[model samples]
Target: MGNIICSHSLSPLSHSTARCHYLVPTSAYDVFINHRGKDTKQFLASSLYDNLQNRGFRVFLDKSSLRVGQYVPEAITCAIRRAAVHIVILSPNYAESEWCLDELYLLIQTGAPIVPVFWKVRPSEDRMEDENGVYAKDFRKHKKAGKFSTETLEKWRNALRWVSLVEGFISEG
Candidate 1:
């Protein structure tokens, strides 16, 4: 994508609060990035955020956009809704985090454009249901612990399957 020039200026509402104010904005962001922080925060996600920002895109990356003491769920939901596009980075342990799964479900619900980046994992691996599959193992643990309802777990699985079908980038590293 080429550099996008946004007419509206985005300013922080207050240093003490985690709210941002936009001027006559149709959407708050050109892109919203969803990723497993532990997996990609130090490298891929931060690099992508910086690159996109340098290219003049209004990107919402949780680590950069969110403030201290911010209500995480609300901030994430708002950013997702206001983004024109979403980029979901599917790391090896992506499905292990309920927060990541919930974010994926919400991203699917919005019906917005989504770009999935498979990092060190394949789409087929993501959809695997065998005992040896990492995703399957994590989900089994979730089920055993009763951390999420069966219906919600099903929805997460469906979300993964749906995203795996979408045309996306694959990174061996």
Candidate 2:
């Protein structure tokens, strides 16, 4: 190949090794579906998981493996860590659930690529608030109860903002 532009400095690759620096993709479960259990589990998430599984992907879905006595949250965390790619189905009620937010925070922390699929919502309206666009109203409810830490709440907020900005697939339903 001829001289290619250096992605970092916007210069030519004739004398740079930048072009040779390739990122190694993460390995493990081929895909992880992060979605609200009640909102999309029976529909969107399941359909996506089914499609991917049919195509020979090692998919991880929280609903399928939840344990009764064991720590479910920890199990979910482990699944996220083992997933190569994540498909986050962003539904209207996504940000409300504490468990969902926790899973999302972990996904963000992983720094792995996430496929944010908008369901019944758009970026213009994907706002994490208590009484506004895309209301994560549960945050307000949980905050009042004082069950979750301030740091965890903040982390969920930040993660929501990041996910909202990520460009991904969208659906009318």
Best by lDDT: 1
Model 1: residue 138 alpha-carbon error in angstroms: 0.8
lDDT of 2: 0.68
Task: State the TM-score for model 2.
Answer: 0.76
Task: Supply the global lDDT for candidate 1.
Answer: 0.77
TM-scores of all candidate predictions against the true structure: 0.84, 0.76
Candidate 2: residue 51 lDDT (0-100): 92
Off by over 4 Å in 2: 1-27, 65-71, 129-131
- lDDT values for all models: 0.77, 0.68
Candidate closest to the true structure, highest TM-score = 1
Residue-level error in angstroms, candidate 1, position 97: 0.5
- lDDT digits (tens) for residues 9-115 of candidate 2: 31111222232222112354778899888899998988888899899998888776555753554455566666889888888888677667767777777788998
